[model samples]
Target: MAKYVLRLFDDRIGVKAQGSLPAENRIIFIADGSATVSAGGGAATLAANSAFFSAAETTVTGGAEGAYVLRYELVSVPETEHGMLTGENIFSELLLNASMELEPGDGYLMRCDRVDLPPGGIAYTHTHQGGGIRCLLRGEFHVQTQGKEHVINPGEPWFEAGPDPVLAWAPDHKPGHFSRVMILPRALKGKSSISYVNAEDAGKPKLQRYTIFADEFIAI
Candidate 1:
């Protein structure tokens, strides 16, 4: 099996700030304000709530109003530049770092998507075909997995190992939402990875919705 590390970073850039992201498979999400990202001989201006993917080294410049960016990347080794606050007006905080082991094969797919849960919605116990890192976007929820329970709040990140069963639910008073990036087998492209543990749950009502942002094939 080949080992990889999935990392999530929160970056704050000032109006005059600019920097380069290392050459790797990455998903860049614009959380607030805007940014201009150039990669692979192309440049695009991404507004808040939108995202894009890059497979090569990328240059990023904050917009006139600065920006709050979320970066998710896959690397062979864990990066040391975690909590860096540079005088150049760029600030970064590493939110999640998790290891993933995958069988060497043809190619893989990198998917970035958002999940929305209505108030009191519950995702029955289930497992996925691949692992991923999820960051809560709004409201609050609790996740039960591996005999442990965790309360996730906005801006917090968590990791889920694919084979381990997970059960998540949102509070009755408010809706919950989160965004995630997953590494999966190429065959799963445009497919859902979730599998309910109990066959009966498959017929239950599902109150969650999804929005796909980036789904690209990648070389291992």
Candidate 2:
């Protein structure tokens, strides 16, 4: 088995500026504006809300107006760089890091998706088959897990270790939306990752909707 760390980064590139992304298996999501990513002798333009994956060192050049992006990386060692801003007007923040183990010959998939909940919507107690990092994109929600509770707001990120029971709910007056990148079994590709912990909850009305952005098999 090989141990790995999954990290999420929030980045901003100034107009006409360029930045280098460390070589790793990574998924980059353009949150705002546009940018051009070059890797492996190829370049692609990523507009807002679009994402792409790269397994090698890559360079990103900001568009005429600059860009804001979220990057998720899987690496073999822990990262120590924590600088917030550099001279190039680039800003980077480390949001979350979780350790995991991968077995040889096992199939795995990397998925990025958005979940939306209407006002007062609730995701009853449930468990997932794999773990990943999630970032709240809009509104607010409350999470209960491991005997503790947390109120999550926009821009806040959290990690969910697979198999831990979780219960989340949005406020009665506001809706909640979030984006996440998860590492799951290849068998779950294009399928739901959630499983209700209680039988009764399974029969309840499910109020959350999902929008998948990227789902791809990953080499382990």
Per-residue C-alpha lDDT of model 2 across residues 110-202, encoded as one tens digit per residue? 899888999999999999999898888789989999999999998888999879999999999988888889989999989999999999999
Winning candidate number (TM-score): 1
User: Candidate 1 lDDT, tens digit per residue, 1-220?
Assistant: 8777898998998895888876778999887899899999999998888888998878888998888888899876445434233448898888988998866555789999989999999999999988999998889989999899999999999999889999999999978898899998888989999999999999999999999999899876
Give the range where candidate 2 is weakest over 10 consecutive residues by summed lDDT: 78-87
lDDT of each: 0.87, 0.84
Measured with C-alpha atoms, the lDDT of residue 149 in candidate 1 is 97
| Residue 90, model 1, lDDT | 91
Worst 10 residues of 1 by lDDT: 78-87
| Candidate 1 clash pair list | none
How many pairs of residues collide in each model?
A: 0, 0
